[model samples]
Target: METVMGNGNGQATSGGRAANAPHSDLVLPYGDQRNDGVVQVSFTLPVAAGPLAEEAARQTMKLMGLEDPQVAEATAIGEEFTFFVGYGKLTRAVELSKLRVAAPMWEELDQAAVNQLVQDTLGRPMVVVGAATGSDAHTVGLDAILNYKGFAGNRGLEAYSAFKVVNMGSQVPNEELVAKARELGADAILVSQVVTERNVHLANLTNLVELLEAEGLRDQVVLVVGGPRITHALAIELGYDAGFGPSTRPQDVASYLAQEVSRRMLN
Candidate 1:
């Protein structure tokens, strides 16, 4: 006898239960029933909200592989922009067990532990210089990691006695960031890019790498990037040590730096 359980979809599926254990194989976007393939998407178009705009939204959804697309809501923003919410069937399944991602191998330690490790191993404060570089003038992400008052009430790197943090603020150029990092003899460089329009972040980040390599400083420091769209794999591909996404706390970055510094310099 197999016991049934309610998955994200409202269906009570045994799902090939073995010893009362649910199988983790193929998965679909659940709406109200198992394998229903329901999904909701939101987007903005540069057209005013009206009957034509509603039709456009539905047609766009269809082009995106959605079937039986229904425009749930359409609203006009100011005068020229239209925001749309649409629902449809995705009809796609992915093997959850087959998917792979780059996972962090280091352990995250608290402020005291990190400080002690740095002091005992390096005998000096680890210097980190961070900024929001390029035309991306957003500083919220950079500030959250470097400012003493961190995001979500977590203490920033400044709280760690073994770290010397220098937050260069927003709109810093790649040249200046690299120069400052070189000047400070920084052990790590953190860059936050919020604007990803036309994949500009890629260009900016790559340019920084090229500059660092030209200056012969690429291998000497840990380079990390963070933003809403960044991922660990993407960062590694773009010549960075690591990447962080939204809601990343200061402690998270600090802990990674501590372990990474020890790994790079101590060992």
Candidate 2:
């Protein structure tokens, strides 16, 4: 059975979460002390709220392999629905050695530096087209990176002098985005996917890649994707050159584009 969370759009999932599960070079969640394996988990059950629901939640934690399960809170949401917040300790930890790590010796350039780099490399403004493609209606992420006002006080791509940006807004079709990129001879394409329900972002992003390939324009542009759940590794797997997740500043992406476009031009 699926559990709804956060605006009733998210479905609670379980995988044994190998990334967080214990293995070699164990790493455990810390709440009070290091390696305490303390964790807080929240979920909803179809049982009515009360003492029974809290007990059920604690047992559920035990079934999840959590030790010392404590049902912190239980509240009734519906006639037969109860939301629970539980605290527990895991008997295991995640292995650090199995993860990918990178240490790039490059710094994110400022807006001025980004413009200078583009001017120095291409001798003209770089055309970059961006959109919240497919049925993704959330434009906050896209606007934050592309609008001149920026996000969290950092300036955006539109503020960069060397960038010719065309933000196509939200719900843009994959074909329309490709056509716009081709139409503008874009040097880069930035796609934002805020909706990932049931891994829809994966299919949408993959379709964009296929479209770019079909149009024979994949090699001609730097493809970038960003969102809350996006990762560089996942983006690479989806055929994107780069991916920016949550809390990524616009300058960070601008620096990457500056460096990538510059390197491509020199090549």
Candidate 3:
């Protein structure tokens, strides 16, 4: 496969990679491994579904650099709105070899290992206080990690033998979370923020960190945040010890907490 250079605008330049490369260097859109450059996209338009609306959708896709744009499906949404699914050929090929992402540093552990680590290292039950704080009322992420039922078939922190989990549910205040953690002598603090409207989660998360710092408890506990938009890098940037993203299993959190608590205690 030939190597390709992107212009920083996602457009490939004339270049070549190693001819005997083990993996693909440049890749185009593939439908059923046909490599037809076929692309499917869906969007909504203000106009109602009709002949003009279909043309507008096609033209919009064309304007975005798609070739042979076709409005495969169109539906009228309420009165003045129309939704469309379009298919076209993408002209550019992406260089997968050039991609990079922030990688996680924590090693995951199983249920037994996590429990044993806390018991052997800490010599006591690790207290954890978790909540979905601020005006964000979403508790799905918090419940999944703290609740006994867990998420994705993994047992939660409450089910672990070594961690005492305190779930504060939804709409908890930052100050209250800090107070509760202090009151419980928590070894870890987990915050879940699902509502990112206008970057409200950022402010809410930052406020919690600031509150902990003000209370002189910021370095006393393992702090973690989780949400669909949350990333490890973002969590560290917001002064969190770690961040768990969507589809995180309970063992993932339990392992991190056990290791982090032990590390902090030893340090």
> What TM-score should be assigned to candidate 3?
0.85
> Tens digits of per-residue lDDT for model 1 on 87-201?
9998778764454446333466888988988888689999999999999899988888888888899988887888899999999999999999999999999999999999999
Mind giving the per-residue lDDT tens digits that candidate 3 earns over 141-192?
8898899999988888899898888899999999899999999988889899
True lDDT of residue 138, candidate 1: 94
For all predicted structures, in order, the TM-scores are: 0.78, 0.83, 0.85
Better of 1 and 3 by lDDT: 1
lDDT, residue 113, candidate 2: 90
Pairs in clash, predicted candidate 2: 22-93
TM-score of 1: 0.78
Q: Which of the two, 1 or 2, has more lDDT?
A: 2
lDDT values, one for every candidate: 0.84, 0.85, 0.83
RMSD of each: 8.2, 8.6, 6.7
> Which scores higher on TM-score, 2 or 3?
3
